[model samples]
Target: MATSGRREVARRILRLTDGIEESHEVHEPVFDIKDTPIESLENAVNPLVPFLPDIRKHAVTAKKACKNPPPDGLTLDESASIRLYSMEWVPHDKCLYVVLNDTLRSEDGEKVKPWFLYLKLFRTAFERLPKQHLTELENYQRAVDIGMHSLPSNHPNFQQWKKALESAKEN
Candidate 1:
């Protein structure tokens, strides 16, 4: 988990949740599938054993909280899971978000390690997004690409953006 990866995860989390509280301490260790060790769990580090379960727990909690939580009493874990889950129901992305949330909440300094795994999971999940969602995602991606481009020239993909912007402006 290099520093850049950790920051990417943070950026994605913010993009998915619109600025919610997140953890950056979940332990993520790579495993050799060929090696079978019963005690391997003991060596896990991202968020610790107890926090690993938080992903599922928070996911369920997020679903419930979406409909009926106090203004500021519930943890973002649940809400985050619910929204991400709703987006596509792709387990991999949801898993990344869950684990990432766990990492963000963690304090042990193992946050960067899970970056690759989380990104992999995100790709898997993103692949499952619906057609309608793909359009929306493309719109967002195009906006980001244009905003980040280094060249002085205007972005070539401006028609779709203009349509989207005009639609938004009309509303």
Candidate 2:
């Protein structure tokens, strides 16, 4: 994946999960990613394979994208799959995310069946990713959680940010 594509995936993962431990999307009757077979990224998007008569070139572009994985430790092919999912071809509405998200949003569970293998691969890549850590905002939230239970309500530093704001207003 290119630098921009990896950055986008990182940003989306953080935005989607934020303080949550895991990011998830599930349909009715539950298609477990664990049960789905893991496959090469090219094979995973088999429906989009433009090998024979199909004319979609973006699929080929995605397949031809960098095979190296990002720092997250996903396979080279898995990274390619992520890149594919994020790419936009000439027609903005025809993007893979557009179609995949539509399938995800569908009321009918049957629509999602075709995407099982890709979903498994995508979720596997996600599993390898680190979440909501090290950044200043997440650091602050973590600090708050650490003391939130131990501090007494009457303590000077208890909800100290609120007190500090009120003090500033009076001054």
Candidate 3:
């Protein structure tokens, strides 16, 4: 597949996940890691280990899977960290992305402090990925198509994004 096609597929996959709403306005300053030094994935998300079960194991497994990888000029650790964040824990609520997304969207920005180190690694890793471009129309079409084919409508969360997208189209 072409680079843009791969990107659209990945975008559609992300859309299927429980992402934060785009309209949520933040009143507090965002924590960034522009000047922060890099750290191991374990150390980055260690603070969250107590709150999230099996996260350490998940990180270890993810790192092992990507040991020899070099995706888009990133270290193996960066690649594995991204993979770890994407991993789904047994309980849907315990998923790393789900929790992190919730923390990021919290009304009190202070709640996001614990995630600073992990966010720095996550965002930095994503930023280092190679560019992939596609038109908005193509992106939208692919999202719908992917949802229709990959996610059965009978699924509980299917209606969430499906209806939202339909409603958006009507407006």
Ranked by lDDT, the better of candidates 1 and 3 is 3
Top TM-score hit: 3
Per-residue CA lDDT of model 3 for 67-171, tens digit only, reads: 576755788878888888878656667888888877876656677777777878887887676543124434865666566676576654555555655654454
Q: Give per-model TM-scores.
A: 0.28, 0.53, 0.64
Worst 10 residues of 2 by lDDT: 14-23
Candidate 3 wrong stretches, greater than 4 Å: 1-29, 132-141, 144-171
Off by over 4 Å in 2: 1-30, 48-60, 67-69, 131-171
For model 2, residues 66-149, the per-residue Cα lDDT tens digits are: 555455566776666767777755444456776776566555676777778778887786555444322443465455645455
lDDT score, candidate 2, position 75: 77
Distance (Å) between predicted and true CA of 154, model 2?
29
